[model samples]
Target: MAQEHLDRLTAVDASFLVQEKESSHMHIGGLIIAEGPPPAYDDLLDSIRSRLHLVPRYRQKLAVPPLESGRPVWVDDPNFFLEYHVRQTALPSPGDEGQLTELAARIFSQRLDRDKPLWEMWLIEGLSGGRFALISKNHHALIDGISGVDLGQVLFDLTPVPTQFPTAELEPWRASRTPSPVRLISSGVLGAARTSSRLAAAVLRAASNPARAAGVAKEAMTGVADIAWATMNPAPETPLNVEIGPHRRYVTIRSDLRDFKEIKDTLGGTVNDVVLTVMTAALRNWLHSRGVRTEGLELRALVPVSIRAKDEQGNLGNRLTVMRGALPVYIDDPYERHRAVCAAMGDLKESKQAVGAEVLAGAQNFAPPTILAQASRLNFSTRLFNLLITNVPGPQFPLYVLGRELLDVFPIAFLPENHAFATAIMSYNGKINFGLLADYDALPDLGRIGEEIEAALAELLALARAERAGASGNGAAAPPRIGAS
Candidate 1:
């Protein structure tokens, strides 16, 4: 097979790298729990070794061109050591989920070493319920949630029993000769030239039709301005929108898929709407518990929308845009909250806020690294959204690790500055699991948020049931399920 050229990071991908700070870690990962007695370290190592060929990015390290001429590229790590990337550790005796989560939070607090492949997997043993765990972490620039599908598939088996993958036919990977520094610099120079030429051509082509060019320019300018305004002028500040530190805490809650679908079907909202409504209620309850006023106020969440096309399934890096969510938490009625959330989301979809975010993210491609890095600092310098809520789809089938069936898996949400909390959601089999990230200093009782989510979901489900009965000629709808049970 022919050798591939250096794979440079895309603009949005590079932004994640540039946006990194000592106070905020930008990597994403999952804290996974599997049924145990745990698999042997050697067994887990062998499993990953056999599949390493499928993910070349795993073995490659970050390489930046001289003078920051272009985005960082992926190059073979000549000193790559598989054992270092795949680690083994035992949780203390009586290793309950709480202890395991504490360990995960510590790991999440630290930044990945840029010297090697920006990923790691820890095999954790000694959970209370006869189980072990796989703590997976990867840099945001290396893989988005959609692009990380292969990683999950490679590490898990569909059945409780492991299946053998054919390895004999696979070609061995040998480190290619590293290009000279002079060559790398020259490549950057030429790449910059081509980029410049492309931009010039695009400008000239658009300029050929003055009126059309003006219209396009206006749209682009408006999009950039709108995104800036949305980021700067977010909803009324809340307790969750405070400055954060490096330390982090994580907690998770899960909902039944059938339950969510039933609510969606009966309440006349999308699954996404139901999910947002749940968050609205949980956030409202959490604030009210903290003695914060929640009357007639709304909280804004920055929700990410994936723009990756179906054909671009296997490619790594960021391919998503942010959309604003105005969650009406002040509403006392669960049905009213759901309806408002659904309407707001519909408007957001039609408003093209995500398109504007994409346009803004793409502009970073032309920005010099210094300027881009500075922009990142500014972006995180001020408060934007109260929370960054993200939901990614996962395989609905069961997954196993060395015959240890996975009971629950939750994605880690990396918190940005001035954002004390973030939420990540993923669906698998028949459950939708939500992971919460918060500043350790700000929210020591992060577990309460998880409980709140369950409570809120229950409330919404009851409302859906009431709505269903009313439609069936049962009389006016039951009173809203809110406040105390």
Candidate 2:
């Protein structure tokens, strides 16, 4: 038996599984652009394969013992499935936006091999711009969004020079070094006694303060109820919610962070506020173009927030909570949209949604693991939100691998059933890169959506710039008009 029944799945983990569809895997996907000559690609692959030995978990497979309920577990599998996880492919002639989007759709539709450690890397060549793409997928249970970003650093080198990564022996070698079971049991008993004493002291402290204890208990109950409410409610049916086949469409858009910052600096809000504002505008335009018009059509988005501590970078395993917020898609004015998004986000933060998730996470410790896992799946499957939007922060400095400069980085997130699309934005160096993964059949024109996103940002930036000029008593000076393509 596992050391703890609670180890089956954390509440957050269960929620993801419940929402998972055949088209969705809770894994994070990344695109690394590298300038390459065809032959040099082999060298890159060799370097990556050799370094795989350094990350022991990469070689392990998900195993569930017969005594357990067959829940997935990670254990070393000496005879691993390597080829299934890593692959090499080339795009069709002149790999432009259309070809890239097609490739993304194909990649998103396929499921990872669950029998192995859930991860894969694809090296894509033959881009119109003479750049190659590295696409990687890893199981969500293995790494959350923040940790996934950290893992990128491990694979990439900051310096242009080649460097050797640290390596460790296989699990079998380590197991051989372990002491006998008798010694292990003796040490385990002593450790358990110490832990029990500390737990007892903590409980006594809580009991000594009846009023404070009662307040804490009440808060915990409320948090659990809040999470339940959020998860149990089916997401509103939208264009995104439709039966999806095994097909993925990938599209990307890039913008200078300074341009976005300029808008926020003038608008008086954070970068995320600008991002949401732009998305809201684009969504409204897209829906309107599709003849789907409504008054106050509030779109719910599942925003992922990192729960990792400052020191937890590069460490794997999920550590995140979803915050559902209503996007004011009904609004037409750019400035109004910006204000509305900011206000809504501010309210969400003030409401302690993140704290509630933390409390719910804490409550899981007291519940039976199996019960919690079941409850979690039920919550997510019910359509807690209409869509997902995530923002992952990355290193500001340029990253390189074997002297290859990384031009861009994009993130791909799983789209749950009944949810049409998931958008992930990441800041690499000085640029904000947007990656959109959608159900191919449901979102046939995903590339158009990417274009809409660009236009939306441009619209907002124009408004912000004009507003700044007017505020500076330069109304007589005509604001620079944005060019129409």
Candidate 3:
């Protein structure tokens, strides 16, 4: 008999699986474009096969105990086939970004099969330039934004020449025999007991150092209060929040990272502040275009903050918490809007929102599968935020897959029930790419929002230049145009 192996899912990771619904898929990934001719499908397969050992979890699938006695565990998939997870497809006619976006939307619409590993990579050929795109989707239960970035290092090479691993160094793999129902139940009970024991030990340790524990407890309580308040006070209803169908529309916005930094430097705030400002401006204009009055309107964005420590860089599963970031669309001036964002974000950073979220999420560890499912749903209730906005930092240098250089990356964020719009941003190789996913029917004007984003950037850039010129008392000394190096 093969060695029996089992790894239980963390509560945060398990939440994603329970949160997934027919209309709301919980997969997160990106649309990646690379320069140079596409690599042969067989060669790409061979490259992935060699590096499979780096991410052993990818070869495994989930196993739920009989009657859902405990959270699912990761077990090896005996019939694992590389071809099934990695697929190849081509666009028809002269391939362009529009066609690719449509294709990506369709691919993202379908959820991964429950019986297989929760991920897929689609190698798409036939683009306008001598480049190709890869659409990667992984269940949220499998990975989060920070860990996903780590996965990139494993899949892509730093230089143009690809790294090769000799098969002699790597051993063959085999799946352990699947655990029977009785064993699963017993293991679940034991796991629960171990968790309780660990928690009790932590509590005892805290009790020993009462002063330190008191300070931590106070901070946690404050954070919990903020989170509870946010939950009770529902965000204002907007065109962006409504019943979402299974179909989606995907749009991308290309921007230079320098523009954001310039705005931040000229206008006294962080790069993220500039980003939030642009988003707010775009939302204001989009709402107006849709005949909605935007007086005194402040939309809320569910911003995910990564808590993954440096030591846990490559570990999988979610290590994130959410905060309700305010989007002050009511501010008419771009600079004023940016200032408001900076101030609000600064306050949020100092507050206990994220800490409270972590504490609440940790409590789910003791919850049974049924309770965990309901609690997970409640944690992401529609009243908490209007839309989701996530920004992930990436490597500054170029990355290559089989010598093909990765040119651009547009990260995709999944939609929650009744939420029609979400934006995911990734800054790579000096360029910041925005991927906007929307409900196809609810957002036929998604392209219009993309246009508004560009317009907002231009407006902010001009203001920043003017401010710099005034500060320096020389117009020529102001920063060059946005795209300037």
Candidate 4:
């Protein structure tokens, strides 16, 4: 029999599967709000149906080998149905933000079905101010933040006028037949043989050039050492890290992208640096609200770094590593906080943290499924970081879905075991939106945290403006010191 059609999950991708639990659902997606009336359910399905070919994995489901012979593979879901995946729902008339947030939180708390495709899209209507929203949920094993697809990217158009195609012009899709158990086993065996061949080829190349190979090996070892050191030094104890339940609460904060840029240009470092600084300040205040002292506390953030090349933009699965970033909540002054973050982030970029993560993940390519599971657990151990902070850059200009203008987007992040909170940020159309997801019981004050984030950015922006005025020799007095009572 010909080799059954199959694509094995990468070590990084399969790791997400290993990390999932009944309470910890390893899925990452976003909440998108668009202006104008909600599109008809059938019309929306048609739009997605037309573009399913672009993302073939949407129609595919996981297929594990018999007796754990190999890692899971992606196979066509012969029972794939578009309507089942694309759902339509609505809140009561004139639904407010609070109501919508409640709806999203409830939706996010539920896990995606494993037997079918690992994604869902809910078209929510009835928001106050004549708006509609979409809440997407895709298993982390399928997509990462860097290469994640918001339905807008797949269904939206650049202009307000959407592209139109006649119903007759659209072609129907048919999933390939599912493979038998015997075929799955045969494919797993072939896959192992191929992995062995690749390793052998690498050894032959290394032997041909000992000096070059030695240098490469030395760098890999250095990266591994860095990872080991991070693992040994467990993240600091904080209220953010706790035994979280399955339920979740979500809140959003929006800011002008230009404000972040201004801080970067005037105070130095990149926008991401500014983001971390702001988050550090917010965490400081939040901890204090819980009556926890923040003196000399340095929290670690599991910042995921994308290693995907330009040519691999739209490809599915994860191509990313992580860095244990420092959040120096100890610093009180805003400028000092920003400087510390900038310096620490700069050092992390130069360090082998990401390289080490990539090297470790790469080794799993040749390992058995059991070994892969163990390695993945080590890679995302709770001891490694206090919380997850992912910053994904989005399209600067506006996007439209079926002639409706996209107003705002808030990205959703998943929580690992023992992590009570995670923050996901996305910049779109000149606005930086922060989506805060936390355990419903642990963070009943999630809305307060969102307000704190806004206040943090406001303070930073004020300081930046003051610095600019001082540089211009204006007579305006300096603003009050930040973090001062």
- How many clashes in each candidate? 0, 3, 0, 0
Q: Distance (Å) between predicted and true CA of 207, model 3?
A: 2.2
lDDT per residue, candidate 1, 275-325, as tens digits? 899999988888888998888798888888888998887766778777778
Which ten contiguous residues of candidate 4 have the minimum total lDDT? Answer: 476-485
TM-score of candidate 1 against the unseen true structure: 0.90
Residue-wise lDDT of candidate 4 within 293-338, one digit each (tens)?
Answer: 9888999999999998988887788999999999999999999899
lDDT of 2 by residue, 285-401 (tens): 777777888476878888888888888777666777667777899888787777788888887776666768777665543444366666566534527677788988888888877
Error of 3 at 293 (Å): 1.0
Q: lDDT per prediction?
A: 0.81, 0.71, 0.90, 0.87
Task: List candidate 1 stretches off by more than 4 Å.
Answer: 1-4, 160-163, 196-222, 378-381, 473-485
Question: In model 1, where is the ten-residue run with the lowest total lDDT?
Answer: 476-485
Model 3: runs farther than 4 Å from truth? 474-485
lDDT of 3: 0.90
Output the TM-score of candidate 4.
0.95
Between 2 and 3, whose TM-score is larger? Answer: 3
User: Per-residue lDDT tens digits of candidate 3, residues 31-56?
Assistant: 99999699999999999999988999
Highest-scoring model, lDDT:
3
Cα RMSDs, all models: 3.9, 5.7, 2.9, 3.5
Candidate 2 versus the native: TM-score?
0.85
Model 1 Cα displacement at 1 (Å)?
14
By TM-score: ranked, best first: 3, 4, 1, 2
